[model samples]
Target: MEQRHPEKRNDRNTDLTSDQNLKDRPERQESDKAEQDPGERNAIDSNPGERKPAEPNAGERGSRERNRGERQPTERTSGERQSVERASGERNPGERNPGERNPGERNSGNRQGNDRNQRDKDRNEGVADRHEPVDRVAPDRMAGEIAREGRRSADNGSSERQDRSAGERGPADRGTADRGTADRGTADRLVVGITLGDYNGIGPEVILKALQHNRMQRICTPVIYGSMRILNRYRNILNLKDWNLNGIQNISQASHKLTNVITCWNDQNHEIQPGKVTTEAGQAAFACLQRAVEDLKAGKLDALITAPINKQNIQSEEFTFPGHTEYLAHEFGVQDNLMFMVSETLRVGVVTGHIPLGRVRSSVTRERIVEKLNLMYQSLKLDFGIQKPKIALLGLNPHAGEEGLLGQEENEIIKPLIKDLREQGRLVYGPYPADGFFGTRSYRDFDGVLAMYHDQGLIPFKAIAFDEGVNFTAGLPIVRTSPDHGTAYDIAGKNQADETSMIQALYMACDVARRRKEHQDLEANALNPKQVVEK
Candidate 1:
């Protein structure tokens, strides 16, 4: 599981000047009302016994007439004056008591002020409580300003919402979330065959690390195809002797609750040297892979997850392909297969694999591109359960040929093919520039990406998803996936190799197997609608 980082709050102070302006209207006169001391009112009552009612002086009478004349009767209606008085928390001019206010009117200004203060408090405390209804009594201008402010707040606080929801749902719900709710055929456990590649490299180490416990058995019965002697040699070096290596003679004898191992060859006289690729080590790796492939072909295994292999040393008359993808394609008699890389978040396929850069341009023909696209389109719908997959096609030249100035592949080949595919009801798009497409993360909006060459796709895919990338061979009769990496000869026995990618490859094999079965069942039932198929 990937660890989530904490969300950084927008600690910058909010600028509420517009809202403050509305609260300080001239008619309300909050300053004057606040300045009037309560001491003056108490003083008037304290001397009631000695006080005498006096006639108005000439200055006071003149001042009263001037105050009354300032308000034209039509302009300053009694209702408007009362409204202002209620907002300012002041008694009417003719009221008998200093603390008295109109019975029908309350201090709306004071109530609004309290609400604003509470909102500020909640914001500073990092709380977004939507239960409090918005203040409708506030003026239209103030309400508009507040609504915009709320939107800004929501945007700033949206980063960790998914994490927060997961937290609320608790661990059980998180486990279910990890296992998606897609209608993935039957839930039966698959028998996944694991091939040990280049025992001298990090292959054995990662295999041990990936299947250390019985958790994987819940999904599939893993059968490791390699020499038990070689596995023990690496196990002793890495101090993993406590892990079980349940030995089995064949796939049928494998145990579901243990890490089953099937020794494909005897290693009594073989040498064990870490971080070194030799003919003996390569031969042993080939022996294990050949046995596993044979078993898989005979229906003894549901899927195959191959570890990393050294291409040069593994070359022989029996296995004479560039890499695993090519070798598997040949073994299955497949003419066209896609080198599709799958991760939790992204899926990428290349038009050319294990070929020279000089030949990339020539290899990227319309027929070949369409062939890879058809394989990917079917893989997405059947192997991945996506109904209508959207695919992004990358250009052969830089900046997608720049309108034929840099290259003409995009204009002549890619664009025309895309138009044809779309007309045929396939949701394919673009000969987009490779750098901009991956750099801007536009790939996330689509289901898959088809790069024109090996380095163009694998370079970025490994850089971004090296820890969990699974190389799957699409359009093959059988399912085969391997970690998207070669034998790390340098870090072979250092006990430092990360097993994340191998683990992901195993899980991906199981998922793809289940999806393929489900898809086949659906197709069969569709063809024979009158006959019901058993799960």
Candidate 2:
């Protein structure tokens, strides 16, 4: 051969294309074929020093034979481009000289190279391309689909693969989030019907403040049976302009997503002065309570959390009952309901609630005491999820009637009921002196406590759980709770009313509803021994 200059040889080496080299050495064709698959391509690319077998097409094989000592261009495949890039040690084919062939196969151009680099980083960090880009149109996200895919992944016995398949919103995370939302919406949703107790009192203020909590929306839907005008006035007075109230025609129309208000009375002439109790306010309160009660009875509401009503003002032919407790009893046709006050720490129920103290002695009959104890026991079991609750009874007289010396009620009625209940396998305890029973915190020893009258049980309960106490009405067909504190007319407009009690009442109402449903479900499925029980 004629002598070629050293510089010319170097230029030829630099200019020689991969196909030319392949043609010059036809034996190299088999190695290129083995790395055609994208997965195999990635494996080979991960370790560029490792070589894979390749197989050339018949045309290329023939071209290699024909051009024994010459060079020629030929059609390029993606595998060929990858092979050429690998052989040339060009890490990114996209950055190759523009004069090079098959520039599209490596990555695309400058922009695409950057994108591929980022994608490679993401892949290295365990973020694979399982999901489409957010800019792309995607199908709706269904809870069932997410759950099924998760189960399928888990069943495959590769937790890493399962997580990869699930991407960021994995089966467990998405399923929990979606199921939690759905359960809160369906099963745990307490559609609380809130009656605006004397509109002029702290009822509207406390209701507004309590419902304003973001967490309230997650647990229960609130339907305020009050006037929009009145709520707006209070909202403005309390500077709670940020809170939005959805006005609805009826309870059925209330929205679960927002605090709904069903207008019970919207007379512009009616005065709405905070800290003042008026007949109009009482009538409005009664109207709201009446409407809410109707809905509650009609099954539109899960629970009823009443605000306080003025005993003197809210009395007319429409509302002749003493208060919410007596009114609810008559409405439900229950002769008496247990006035159960509940907190996280303790539970207290009274034999005579909302009745005069003088009449309390007469109300402390053996039948009444037994009835209240039975109601309290049942409430502790069903409403509170206690299987066999221990109960303590308080004396009507000081020091438990001093062994019948101070009074005869405790010895005459209370102790006999306790004795009979205990003999019947009930976990009923003593008629301990009210002062000492609560004074020494002995009430904490038992699951529930029964008092002869209102103040007897409530005084200690409020003293301990004042801001958190919830007044629950037991023995009624429906669930009803109220804040332990009454309507504070003095602090109604001033915004001095603490929302803790109302919030607790709302929480208790939802919990009681859930417990009642759970108890009913257990009763219904009691025969099935193998059935899975929910905790």
Candidate 3:
């Protein structure tokens, strides 16, 4: 009996030198038995000196393992054992498994199956994980997966668990949450109310036309207070079949994405004679105005834009006031309000609004002029974002009363008011003659013009900006604007009327509302001058 090298046992014709080696080294014998296949082990034990079958090469053994779908025990080095373990789906602790693909590897069908299985597991756990890095997931797919997971949790009645999961979400999920918050915030555009004035006139026509612009929908949510039946008729008459309105019963149901119409009257049988000023039209107009004003007062509306309404036709027991401006002032409990006419180039306010020519002389007092000027000044600063407003005062008489020759109202009342105002550190100029002031385009030199009467201011305003003028009521607690025109019975249903004024009025209302909010914010957060001095 003799010792033999273990490496020499793999030779095709080698024989064990002796059985004494196996007896002497029991541990080596057991190791060899464990490492060798059963057939080889049996052959070696049967006859120690017998020649064993030639050992298969590494490639052949691997091919045989694949064909048999099982691993065959064979003597191998440490590195070779690791390779075999990896091929057999076994690994050391913390070592990556064979199923995991490297970055450069092509995605095979098996990898896809593994990914799907992982996703299914995540869903069962009520988690929205892709088992991949956040950057590797497409943004849209990530959002969709999160939404699906949320819905699944809701379906399972696991709202509490859903909330907990949201709290535990990573940065990508938090980003999605922030985007959702921003989408909701974007729906907070100014809610503007448009009152369909004098339905028998051009009110409905211009309203439909104004709302057709896509920009209107982007800037504000328009709620029309009128009869939807009449609006639809006008829409069809104007050949605007493509336009649509979301009809809701109440202002709360108004949609931010569509132009909403709230039906104020249910007079389905009422005939809409576009050019006629009938009692029914007046009553219907009042109904719409009343409902709109109710909502305006309740703070549901951010701003209001009224279309043209016939003054004589709209007058009733319920609406006894002269016009929208006066009615809004009385409703808001304000004694003094100015009729502020606004355009891109000129801004005018009347000292004596809706008064007769004879009363204009009486109403053009020093106190009244000062009140209107103060209102215009404040409106310019707050609504128009003008800090130091320069205003021009139009005279009550011709040539500013020619120094008391033509009329003494201007020389006595208006001149004295202007001088006193200038003394008090206010930018108040002239008692300029109304005719020459506008004829020379002097209105452009000032921030606002104070007229002695309504027609005096509005006549020139409409003449200059007939298509774009906005009539804003100054000194009120709320923002209100309207087209600087009346209900045009001449072109009521013809569809020939211009909608520019109505569009500009709506724009001005939203602009003024935003400016007022900004002003209020600045006032609220303003630093105290006295505190600064003390510091």
lDDT by residue (1-535, candidate 2, tens digit) is 2554434533433334343434434454444454357864455335434444464433333333332323334435334554766787775443455345434333335434564455445434422332221111112223233323423432324433333434545556655545544543454456889999988888888889877522255456789898999888887888876446788898777665568889887668886888887889988988998899889888989899999889889999877887889889999999867889888788999888877777877777888888888888888888777898999988889899899899988777878888888889999899899898888999779999988888888888998999889899999999999998887776778988998788778767777787777678778878775666768
Off by over 4 Å in 3: 1-184, 527-535
Lowest summed lDDT across 10 adjacent residues in model 2 is found at 130-139
List runs of model 2 lying over 4 Å from the truth. Answer: 1-188, 528-535
All models: lDDT? 0.72, 0.72, 0.72
Note each model's CA RMSD in angstroms: 19.8, 15.4, 20.2
Q: In model 1, which range of ten residues has the least summed lDDT?
A: 6-15
Per-residue lDDT of model 1, residues 1-535, tens digit only: 2322211110100111112334334533554365357753343335444433573333332232323233333343344454676577766434424333322223334444665565455434322222111111122222224324333323424423322332345445544544432112113457899999998888999998877633354356789999888888887888875445788898888765567899888789887898998988888889998999899889888999999888989988888888888888878888989999998788999999998888888898999998999999999987887899999999999999999999999999999999998999989999999999999989999999999998999988998999989999999888889888889999889999998788778777877787777667767767665666777
Reference-based lDDT, residue 369, model 1: 94
